[model samples]
Target: MGLEVERVNEIAARVAASSGLEVVEVDMRGSGNKRMLRIFIDKPGGVTHEDCANVSRELGTILDVEDVIPGGSYVLEVSSPGLDRKLSRPADFQRFVGSRVKLTTRNPVNGNRYFEGRLESFQDGRLTLELGAPKKKVKAGDSAPQKVEMDLSNVEKANLVPEI
Candidate 1:
């Protein structure tokens, strides 16, 4: 099953790249009656509906020609990582520089297990963030928020917390 899944992703990536889409992730799920193949795609300008449709069409042919999955049938789904996409690598952390992020850590840091702030920069395998909340003020407007800094390893999962 693992080998089959890996091969499917390889074929899917080749096909998707041919169409200008970066294949971010791929996985096969479910059993006998409910097998599903999910593919996550992305690009510099971000993925579009048209991107999914085109990758689907192109990948459909490649999958058929390769005969990668000889099983009865499986569902294929292609999509973007979306706004709150998960960050699993140092590269991912670097990619999201300047965006506000919320992260969960496996162990406590500064007596807490979570951190939220603006991702300032990523260098030398380390990440920097400026954290705090806006101040509330009757005379000025709002109070200054607190600031915090944490290491990337302390991060179990992180995502871009879009401006609401």
Candidate 2:
């Protein structure tokens, strides 16, 4: 039987928590015999190959016993969120402060929908970014460019700019 999306997420979250991990995302693609389920997991330090293997083994058994999926022959993949992990929640933005981020706004901010800079601060559902300095400054000693302040509601997508 095909489980509802919410039910799948709930079950995945429960399983992940019991295994000392958090489910960052769950994506199901294709259908019928070609179904694929990809689960992103994370922890304080990081996840190893063993961690992925363990979660896959345990979750697979649980799903099989529960009959959560509708069809046959589906692939389940469990792994770390990775270096360029997507920022999907408010906590994600807060946790990644001081890191480089590439973001797109739902509407233009400063006549632009795209922005790439160092995340300076995130508070009260707002984001501040240091976009570096402009090439020309009026005086010998002019301040570096002012930070860009944006509301969280305006963000369409954001991702950590991987260092390497």
Candidate 3:
């Protein structure tokens, strides 16, 4: 199943690249006839409905012809990563510097595992975040640091915080 998923990812990346798109993520879920394959794509400006439809049409046909999926049937979905998109790669962190983000670390930093702040910079596999103001009033002795730094490997999960 893992190999099949990797093959689908490779194929999706190839198809997306041919169309001038970047494959953000490929996910497979469920089993047998109920399996689902989801591919998220993006580009410099953004992704359009036509882009999604075209990739879906082309990739779907290829998957059918290649038999990349072992199951009897599976659903393929193609779309853009939304505004609050995930940040999983180093490039993703670098590209979104200065944007607000929310993340969880694999291990606690300062005894806290969750953080939300503006991405100050990403360099040398490390990121520095400028912590946002507290949601509630802060006590004099409870002030948090203005900034925090951590290695990229420590980020268990991260996502852009949509700025409205």
Cα lDDT, all candidates:
0.78, 0.84, 0.92
Better of 1 and 2 by lDDT: 2
The runs of at least 3 residues in candidate 2 whose Cα sits more than 4 Å from the true structure, single-residue gaps closed, are: 1-3, 132-145
Q: What are the models' TM-scores?
A: 0.80, 0.87, 0.95
Estimate the lDDT of model 1.
Answer: 0.78
Give the TM-score ranking, best first.
Answer: 3, 2, 1
Candidate 2: which pairs clash? Answer: none
| Cα lDDT for residue 113, candidate 2 | 77
- If candidate 2 were superposed on the true structure by all CA atoms, what would the RMSD be? 3.8
Q: For residue 69, what is the lDDT in candidate 2?
A: 82
Where model 3 places Cα greater than 4 Å from the true spot, the runs are 135-140
In terms of lDDT, the best-performing candidate is 3
Superposing all C-alpha atoms, what RMSD in Å does each candidate have to the true structure? 4.8, 3.8, 1.4
Tens digits of lDDT, candidate 3, 16-128: 99999989999999987998899999998899999999999999999999988865999899999999999999989999999999999999887678889999999999999
**lDDT, candidate 3, residue 125?**
99
Q: Rate residue 137 of model 1 by lDDT.
A: 33
> Worst ten-residue run, lDDT, model 1?
134-143
| Full-model lDDT, candidate 3 | 0.92
